[model samples]
Target: MYHALLLLVQKLSYEVEEQIFSEVSLAIQKPESYFEMFKDRLDERGIDSPIDELAWISLVDSLLDHGLAFEIDWKESGLYICDVVDELLDRKNMACVSWEDFEDGEFDELPTSLCLNKISGKLKEQAISLASLDIESDCYVLITVPSSDTDEMKALAKEAGYSIQDSF
Candidate 1:
């Protein structure tokens, strides 16, 4: 069930922060790989027998909702417009949209960048400034979250990990 996945993320986050962060981070960055890794881990959890592509997508969504995870994504997310695609399609123009990113494999493309930005905007309206960190140094878009969360994520990547792992 979705609840089990959410609990697995939160309950094991601190105890297994390294693995947890890696899976959540990869869920968006490399879903195919993420799923391969996730399925293996899910099988280990004993949550479901032979765990074949469970509602892992919802698990990721729940993680963001609880501020337990953040995503690396495009910054020009504002440019994504479903209406334009719709109008183009109305004219019978050849076009294709993929929601495979979220695993539904349907619906319009909703980039994680736009979703994360909207989350930042909502936090700002509430006087909270979610930290935008540049662990990978792409210089285009930064991973957005608070210091602690980002710090954990930083430890998972080659460019972001601290030189001293014992401290992390």
Candidate 2:
């Protein structure tokens, strides 16, 4: 059930991510109840991971408070969600994938073709894009790097003058 929820959240269309928060917020105002709703979902499935449920609840709250309305282009949002989901699944897999199966010693190695400088630059690009959006100062940036490379990426991110979230 937890896996299914993860998949559903991951499969959430980009527009849904952008719009559902507002819709849900307007549909339901009580933050405590909102949390309970998610907790209920997890409880219904007998999922034991409290942390995971809390993460989703927080994400929903953050989305609503920030006025993150979905972009109108269905195709674009759909594609964006797909990419986000894929990235998420990859990160999820990294937590379980064995080190021996990894070709390189470093599981966190940036794609060889994608230069580290470019990847770091892209984070800045995202930072800029996010600023153009309605995200608040307290809004957090969630980076899902390979589990093996999380520490290094996090350090690099900090060095680049960007704050990184340690947890979702």
Candidate 3:
């Protein structure tokens, strides 16, 4: 099972994170339940019922593709709920950085590449992009990386002047 460490840097506020989760949950839940409602209709049509699970999973996968959901680690078990969020920060200028973007085909040396300087550079780049949008709000760099890289990620984040806000 693969897991991701959600590093919310810059503006560290639980309220913002919780609000994002709440809004996203409500948004996805509506469509998810709508799909679930089809089970009864299928049953009435003499088809195998209880397709709720599959339907819900499909809807969630679609949401993930559209950046409406974030993946977080769930110990060693592969079964886990994806983290849903409406936004990473209150500002519209926030940037999201995924660990996959840093991969250079050398899986063995991937961790070594996630160093302080590189991570900080990425953050700076994101900040600059936000600035161009006339956004003076605190810049945030959210990273979604595997659980195995949590510790190293934390260390690098600290070195990059970002405090660890939350991890799942």
* Backbone clash count, each prediction separately: 0, 0, 0
Q: Give the TM-scores of the predictions, in the order they appear.
A: 0.23, 0.26, 0.22
The model with the greatest TM-score is 2
How many clashing residue pairs are found in candidate 2? 0
lDDT of 1 by residue, 98-162 (tens): 32342443322445445444434443443333333232332222222332343444343223221
lDDT of 3 by residue, 55-163 (tens): 2233223323334333332221111110111142222334454445445544324332233234434444444111010011232223333334445545543554333
What local lDDT does model 2 show for residue 4?
Answer: 32
Q: What residue runs in model 2 are displaced by over 4 Å at the alpha carbon?
A: 1-13, 17-19, 23-28, 41-56, 60-103, 107-168
Better of 1 and 2 by lDDT: 1
Off by over 4 Å in 1: 1-67, 79-121, 139-168
- Ranked by lDDT, top first: 1, 2, 3
Better of 2 and 3 by lDDT: 2
Extract clashing residue pairs from model 3: none
Q: How close to the true structure is residue 82 of candidate 1, measured as C-alpha lDDT?
A: 30
On lDDT, who's better, 1 or 3?
1
Q: Which candidate should be chosen as best, given lDDT against the real structure?
A: 1
Which residue pairs collide, candidate 2?
none
The Cα error of candidate 3 at residue 129, in Å, is 12
